[model samples]
Target: MNHTKRSGTPVKRSLKVALVYLLVGGLWILFSDAAVERVVSDPEMLTRLQTWKGWAFVAFTGGVLYLVMLRQFQNDRVMLDRQLGQQEEIRRLSQFQQSVIDNANIWINVLDPDGRVLIWNRAAEEISGYSSDAVTGSDTVWEKLYPDPDYRAWVLERVSRIMAGDEEAEGLETTIATGHNGNRTIAWNSRSFLDAAGRTAGSIAIGMDVTEPRAAESTLKARERQLRTIMDNLPGMAYRCLYDEYWTMKFISSGCRDLTGYEPDELIDNRHLPWVDLMFADESDAVSSAVDDAIAAAEPFSVEYRLRRANGDIIWVWERGRAVEDDGGMVLEGIILDVTERKQLESRLSEMATLDPLTGQFNRRETDRILQEEVTRAERYGRKLAILWVDLDHFKDVNDSRGHAVGDEVLRSISLRLADSIRTVDTLGRFGGEEFIVVLPEMSVDEAWDVAERLRVRVADEPIRVSDGDPLTLTISIGVAVYPDHAESAEGLCNMADKAMYQAKDQGRNRTMVFSQVAGTIESDKSGEA
Candidate 1:
């Protein structure tokens, strides 16, 4: 926009003006001289008039030259003013462009074809901690930014390829050592410009600092690894799933293979099977209801249910979960643990509390409970109920001769035979040592007598084989009592049955007796079995 201004008119234009004036004045002089000669012949007078005409021509020519020079000067002034206004506009536009570049937030730098820094903006200065004065017209800033020789070489090569149009510069990244900050990562985009002749000129590169974003990405990846480790180490399946009947899985841990005999990928998205399909059909409704209720209450849920594995084996599982809000809407997050072993242990403990250890029949306490329940049911329905009280005959003599182990074996064998002789609806239990009770519901007194006779025969007809001795012949004495016939209450009925049992033992070692038959007997008439 700046150039030297000439002080006066151009030499070529001034010479052209002088030539035109000479031609016009010469023509006028020749014409005037010819006309004066033709009009007058006197020598002195002609001389005088010619002198005047010469003077007049000189004056007029002088004025014409003055007017021409004045007009030329005015035109030159107008041209000079226009040139000045154009230069001023060019300077204003250049200043505005510089201001925009300097105020931009991103780094902007330009390099010459020889790799010298041509332009560096304020942002580049702030980011690199090198002022424009320090970086412009020099290439040393590259060494400061890339302190490592190998890295610098790579960066330079990449930039060269980009400037040569051999490689794209979009999203190109580099790590630089900053003057103030320890280090920074930058993402760059670049373009090469051309001169007026379309020849390769310098290049401009724009960069954004990405150090913080890269650091955050690294931290996020590390935490993801840690979370994966924890999930893999867990003994149960950890999951995040949609709250639907399919329990569509979004994420499932590696422990799923061990828990359900299905891989995580198999269960995710119900690729193989829906989570609900793994539960027992009978228990699914109850489990679903429990989970739904807990979710409705905005509380956590805990449920124990059976699951069928991929191998088709059923196992008990305990699940604890809660509804959680997620990007995909409400979902379930939970853990499911195998609880088959615990359930088995609980079952064993329950059996121990209510079953006879040696005979595997209901124990005395459980028998009493059953008797009371049956009595209540029969009374409510006006149904007949009967009980048979059976006693092993001469069982103490066997214990005294062959040891208690053999005697226990005989008792167990006899209990089994008695149990086999009754209907499935009848309840048989070990009432005490050498005695058992059989409860029959909806049975008349005569029907009870028949069942008691069958039980007595069933024991006497078989030989009880003991592990320590040869098979021994065994017999049992049974006494029968009917509800509402012998007594009203469970306890009274039991007493009547016991009296009948003692009466049978007194009458014979192997027989049946009714409680009514022994009720009228004198107390002194009751005797112990021989």
Candidate 2:
């Protein structure tokens, strides 16, 4: 009824419907003709049936056109569905990329081909003191980040290198001074980002604050310098020694030259004398024993021994060391110090306290110390210790007649005689004023009396020929005491022997006496009974 031109599908459907209509119409006409011929008066019925068939054929043709239009509409709907799915996928991928740039921990900043800031992560906002909303679309963002002219030029140079196919710029790590937060230094690692066309669009950088690490490195270097200074300026030798058979010196400070007259290089790495060879033979065992005790206890140790110097002088050194041990109680390290000057000063003070300065003999204080030491030895070994107290008779007369000089000569002569008359184990000391004390360790009272008598006889017989062309003869009255026999305490024994000497003086003034129950009894009378 519309009289419109048909489409290709509609035209094909029309042709198919028309062919069906023709076949149906022909069949109906034939049926009608047969009916007319059969019923001689059925011509009206056949014409009515033919008109109904034509109306049915028109309806079928309209239905075929509607079906073809519906199929085309369904195909168009399917294509629209596939296009919607692709658009959704593209939106999801864009959101994922944006989330990655926003949530990353490292500072990531991207710039467009024209050097305008395009994207900035959260880390970059916090570090650069500029938010993404402020920096995005800013063409001079890097200029604001780095204000120094030289630093900006350096960054541009690196960027140029990256654009010229140089991958070395990718690994570029450097410090930059940013104007933000009062011009602080930032360490950044940079890489070039390329577009879909493989052209370098811009650069992305990650940065952190490296000032603290740089300061820490500088402090470590300063501390090392201070340690070296202290080691170099120390007064005495400081050394690190190994625990091997050689006890090789691994490190020796510069003070080695002052202590042992050896250079530091000569001692380090066992270039010169080893530890065992440094000490005297007689003292090596004692030093080793002390070291062993220190190592076992993880404590400090000290020993006084004789060390041979480079000048062949046997200097007495006091060595103090500490043992450094591992968890297993093994000696892993050792630090040694030289105490030679301290030892010498101690020895000098000891000599001043114990020796008579005029005669170079042991004083009363020294006599007491020697007696106490001998007492300890006697108690330990079940041996006897003897002591002799000798006084010069008529020595005051020499001082009264000539002078103290002449008396000093006589005293020196007596001191020599007394020293020459005793064994090496015996101690001879001046007990002040013309009086002398002798300590004999591990000797019986009999042997002590013999030694005292010999000293007395020698002093009396030996005369001093003075510069005044006169000979002065003197005799020594001695008092002998035995430890644990005559007295027990050092003080008690000295007092007892002193009383015995006075007793001898009261009896004749030139004789040897022993402190006994009978006080004034002379045991030997070796002064020739005067």
Q: lDDT value for candidate 2?
A: 0.74
lDDT tens readout by residue for model 2, 278-396: 67788888788888887788778887778787887777766677766545543434334566677788888987877888888887777777878888878888887778888988777
Query: What tens-digit string does per-residue lDDT give for candidate 1 at 1-530?
Result: 12323534467677887898889889988999999999989989899989999999989988887898799889999989999999998888678658777788999988988788988888888888888998899989889999999999999998788778677699888999888878889999998888999977989999999889999999999999999999999888899999888889999999999988999999899998888899888898998899999999999999999999989999999999999999859999999999999999999999999999999999999999999999999999999999988999889889998999998888788878877888998899998899999999999988988888777776777778889978898778777889998888999988988888887877866878777745466122122332
Over all chains combined, what TM-score does candidate 2 have? 0.61
Q: Global CA lDDT of candidate 1, please?
A: 0.87
lDDT of each model, Cα atoms only?
0.87, 0.74
Error of 2 at 490 (Å): 7.1
Candidate 2 residue 186 C-alpha distance from true site, Å: 3.1
Please give the distance, in angstroms, between residue 286's alpha carbon in candidate 2 and its true position after superposition.
7.7
* Clashes per candidate (backbone, < 3 Å): 0, 2
